[model samples]
Target: MQTLYLSRLQHYLFCPRQFALIELECAWEENVYTAEGQVMHGKVNSGGHDTRGNIKSVRTLPLGHKSLALEGVADVVEYRTDEHGVQIPYPIEYKRGKPKSHRADEVQLCAQALCLEDMHNCKVTEGALFYGKTRRRHAVTFDEELRALTLEAINDCRYIIESGITPKPIYSTSKCRNCSLKEVCHPKIFNKNAKAWLSNQITANLNEVRQVNNNDD
Candidate 1:
């Protein structure tokens, strides 16, 4: 398996086509929304680790697993030491937007957890997602379900990237409205193909009936 970046999971969840376009095709277009996100992440990514008492706040921590062929950097990690001097790793991800309706954010956070677990050999049971809009932290538990989802997403992303073919655009009013590639994707154009196919089927059936009638005459 090729090495995958943890960020790919976020892109995959946002829109698989977008994920492929960026990662596979090396295509990128920065909008105001993305620009704001980059600015917000810069603050977190630029800071160095700060140790206070038994807790250490590390920023832009590089994490990866060669075995799984995955790698990425975490925005922040709170390494807490217990009374016995055992260290616990907790990942924190910063998001520019408010909480979304889907598990895309959670999947991204969980991928960070997986990377931390692999690199540190520590059990990371949870992580946090800090929303820039709300200025609040949402705790994400890295349970079996979430971990499974994350791994599944990685596999799906690998398949998509390996295939090197973008999936057909799904005609979704809600998704298309917010998609950056809406104009390029032209979901309506693909939708018309469906209607066109139906029309062709109708015409073919009519022609077949006419041939049978002509033979009978």
Candidate 2:
């Protein structure tokens, strides 16, 4: 597999076109929202030491999976020891917004967990998602389902990048309005024909199947 960046998951979650533009097409344009996010990350990336007894907080730790060829820097990792004196590391990702109604944020957090698992050679059972808006941390459990989803997203991203084919835009009025790539993707114009063609194909298939069944009867 080709090397992956943790940031790609964020891009894909926001918009596939955005992901393709940055990762595959090497296109980049910054807006105020992105600028603010970068500034927040910068603050988190700077070194700061904090200790609560045996637990320690490390910021901006480099993480990678050589086998998967994926790498990135984790925002914060809490290190603690178990009863048996074994060290444990948990990753924490900071976001500028509150939780959404989708698995996009979870997918990104799970990716970080996977990275920690690979780098530490240990089971990272849980992590945290800190939302700037809410000023709260949501603990995420890295269960089997979440890990599977993370792996799937990573594979999908790689396939998309290698194919160099941007997925046809999905013209969702709400999504289009919020999407940073709306102008670049032209969702309304580009998706109209594709959506129509798909609907036609589905209708044709249904009719053909119905005819076949009637003839059999």
Candidate 3:
């Protein structure tokens, strides 16, 4: 089985079709939001490690879990010493924007925490998401609810990937408007007229084949 990316959890959560297009079909496009996000992650992963009183920060740590078949590079993982003198792994994800109403970010963070737990063979009770826009850390606990949601997303993505079929687009003004793949997705145009669109595409391909045969003659 291919390793599922932790980052792709957010993609699937936001839109399954988006996840399928990028992961299954290897389709991508960049817009201002994604560009800024890449810039933010670039800076975050620039090996800018530092040490505080009891915390040592590690940048761009590659994490994976064989059992879950999930992997990704975390932006930052802080090793914080507790009163008992044991260090705990705390994941911190960097985002270019503020938090949204959806649980995508939270699920992504939770998946990171789960990977850490699996690799370290210890409990990672919490993690944090640092938004560049807000300049604040939103701490997420690995509670039952969040963990269940994250695992569900992982399973959902696994099924989609294994099927090797790109999901049909379902548009939403709030979510699809700023999507980088909006033009590629044509969510609004295609989903509404799915049958007609498929028929037109098939007809165009048949026409191309007919032209090719004529040229061969």
Q: Each candidate: how many clashes?
A: 0, 0, 0
List lDDT for all candidates, in order: 0.86, 0.82, 0.92
Give the per-residue lDDT digits (tens) of candidate 1, residues 1-217: 8888988889888778778877777777776777898999988898688999999999998888877788889899999997889889989999987999889999989988888888888899988999998999999999999999888999899898789888766687776776666666677675567878789889999999999999999
Where is the poorest 10-residue window by lDDT in model 1? 183-192
For every model shown, what is its TM-score relative to the native structure? 0.85, 0.84, 0.88
Q: Give the per-residue lDDT of model 2 (tens digit) for 1-217.
A: 7778887887787677778877876777666667778988988999776889888999988888887788888899999888999779988888887887777878888887777777778898988889889999999998999888888888889889899898777677766776666667777777778778788889999999999999999
Candidate 3: residue 32 lDDT (0-100):
97
Candidate 1 accuracy as TM-score: 0.85
Displacement of residue 13 (Cα, Å) in model 2 is 2.9
Highest-scoring model, TM-score: 3
Weakest 10 consecutive residues of candidate 2 by summed lDDT? 174-183
Once model 1 is optimally superposed onto the true structure by TM-score, how far is the C-alpha of residue 196 displaced, in angstroms?
A: 2.5
lDDT of 2 at 149: 81
